[model samples]
Target: MAKVIVLNKEDFEKLSEDVSPEYPFLKDNREIMSASPGGLFRCLMVRAEGEKENMLIAQRKDTLYLGYGRDYRSFDLQGVPVEHIALEEPKAYQEHAVFYHRPSHISDLNGQNPLRPVPERQTCFQVEQVVVLSDEQFRQFQENGLKDDQIFLFDYSDKMWFDPGSFCWHCVLVKGENSRDGILVDAEGYSYARYAAFAPDCDKLRLQDVPVHYEYPARAPEQKKTRKRKEPER
Candidate 1:
């Protein structure tokens, strides 16, 4: 069993905006109503259960209704005690009401774990550039004495071969730098990496791109020799 953290409506509302900026779609959607703190709190409560399924809700006309999963557990929001009322399942409700699960690994609340307390200062990563490379190109990068440390971003999305569907982002700490780069890995093993260079000029190293790359590590001796030989005596 995991310990839960309860955030009140006020705190939840304040944090939701901060959270939105982290997501590209939400940041672009100006018309979308910002999620209420109560709603965000409820979502986090449900997420702590480690269940990635959509939560079920019973709406009472104009008033928004909240409920547990198919189990039909009832909950309250802003003094409104939600009651379970059955009606023809509306597709719009199904889509809009359903809150997607972000997975438990990244959602864990342990303070000791580096990845647990995400959305904190340490987890932040700036963006630099987005480099679209083929598998062979990536391999060549590896062969050319490029170390993973030199590259800020590494893909860990579900599309990749070894994703846990957590969508948790990680940072690569490079020496001689005050901060590290951020990397988001989805369940399918697909990855999006970001670096400090990606930070906007005006921002104090906050804003970041969906995916970016930084520097790679040093090359091996043989790799250095091969590069020297290929230099055409220049």
Candidate 2:
């Protein structure tokens, strides 16, 4: 668990200098400051291993939201019925929505397992497309489509186990640039915070398709008592 520290512009700049080599995005970008007041910023502490990554996004407004996860889903920016975002796969004419959710299997509250499953909630965000001038082919996004801000989803049920001092954990979207190889950004500090950006023109993109399942634990049986023993005692 990492402690939350509010950094002034100078502190943020200094911290950026310290970690910018590995995460070059923090080097010369003025836009990083856009995450102010209640805007989103990545935590510079935790790292995720291989496919099992974790990331954190934080906001400082009237309220706060956070999310952390490894695997993520993809979504279409232009589509009908917002529920379409939850669709299992991307459709050919229809746009798609994609993002990550903590798979439900581990959260099952029943079964003989002593580990109490954490409760997860559906947190949604709208994805919009932006052009990455650096890369002729790659597409960029504006955080969560806000004028200058982005939104994220989080599950705080296990704050006690992972981050006892914090109230919740969150995943956030950050502006990224396109490189010759792929979309790139300096997210090493918050690698645990998995990121999912909207894919434009669903033709080439593949969204993670997960089967939905629900489970309910069986109720405990009531105890039964025998009456024959009472007569012998008398």
Candidate 3:
């Protein structure tokens, strides 16, 4: 069973520091760095099956990465080797949502804020669960067509790949009147929106013209449909 626990800034820091020895890779990881710069509260943490899987939601910085496969994907914290993970999911996570909160940079530049009562918009996606994908499992999905259910989230970080070049991971969900939203905890441990592409009457991915690529080898050819014998003979 997996447990989701919310930790305060202090507790989260202490826990992360304690665990750092066992998971040295986490020490300098961007997720942890961005989420808790100098021990600031940035995300939620998850542990599954007594250290079987440990995941966190790291915060993302502004100034998004544009273009196809801008960066590598996969968790170095996981057992998978960093190089292999990158090769498998070459594109960086790309489906990022732009937040419109009070500019922290501006606040820093100015000494004090006169707008005391003003509140910034909350830019958070309520996380429902974490989807852990391994290299072997991902390859299997490639051989077998990727089911809609298999995708927990869309290409927020674009790290989650379902297809190849046709849609690099950076594609965003199409805007629609009745689109449903889902939450995915990224490799960095941040929450991002995952729009349902298979929903009824929603050709979201197709509409976006997102390129599709498959890394695995293709299976046997599908049998073609043949027309029945002409009835004119009768």
Candidate 4:
């Protein structure tokens, strides 16, 4: 998942007018989208993409919607929850959500939408098995022969989603053939170290999503890494 930047509705509407002027990179799209999710009460989701320095923009937007118990751009039980934003694969777009009021009554842990899955303390990507590439297993790719980087070693892990204030919800640990310290890669091949990963590089790395698994090894405790609720880097 990409970094989502939630913004107040009024503030979101004024993104091109106010925020874009200072940050000329965002000036390209002088159109503030009507990305309101369902256009329900106050919860809205605008598109944020095609720009560099997304991290810096998110940080700046946070300051705009700081107080009021995060009502301005925080809770949206009916719409895209923070879990979806925090725990998905790394991508270019960012969510500029605007919540008029926090859905304090709605269960943040349990989702109300039937189509979408609710992330609980149990939802995660658990490593069921690890395969060590054998010599005979190395001759699969066509034309290019077997390359070391082609080998994939996913470390045992669990990316259970935590509270709404988390960005490190789920990530698969990848150990490449030439890797020294190993790599923590998201579904989009974004490493924990923030190295850009092309899709082709991680084409063979397929990690399964296990909402809840007890047959595997011990799972990582919920909220251990996400307790602080930090945002992911761009």
Q: What does each candidate score in C-alpha RMSD?
A: 22.5, 25.8, 22.3, 19.8
Off by over 4 Å in 1: 1-24, 29-121, 148-234
**lDDT tens digits by residue: candidate 1, 1-234:** 111223344443343334322322222222222234354422222121222322322222233333344321233334333222222112221000111123222122223346534342333222223333333444343234132232223442222231136322332212112223212221222122212111112222323343433333332224433443455654
Global lDDT of each candidate: 0.27, 0.26, 0.30, 0.27
Q: After superposition, how far is residue 62 of candidate 4 from its true place, in Å?
A: 29
Q: Over 4 Å off in model 4, which ranges?
A: 1-5, 8-210, 225-234
Candidate 2 has an lDDT of: 0.26
lDDT of 3 by residue, 204-224 (tens): 112222332222232223599
On residues 87-106, what C-alpha lDDT tens digit does candidate 4 reach at each position?
12223321111111112111
Candidate number achieving the greatest TM-score relative to the actual structure: 1
lDDT of model 3, residue 179 = 26
Model 4 Cα shift for residue 66 (angstroms):
26
Give the 10-residue window scoring lowest on summed lDDT in candidate 1. 91-100
Q: Best-fitting candidate, measured by lDDT?
A: 3
- Determine which window of 10 residues in candidate 4 has minimal summed lDDT: 94-103
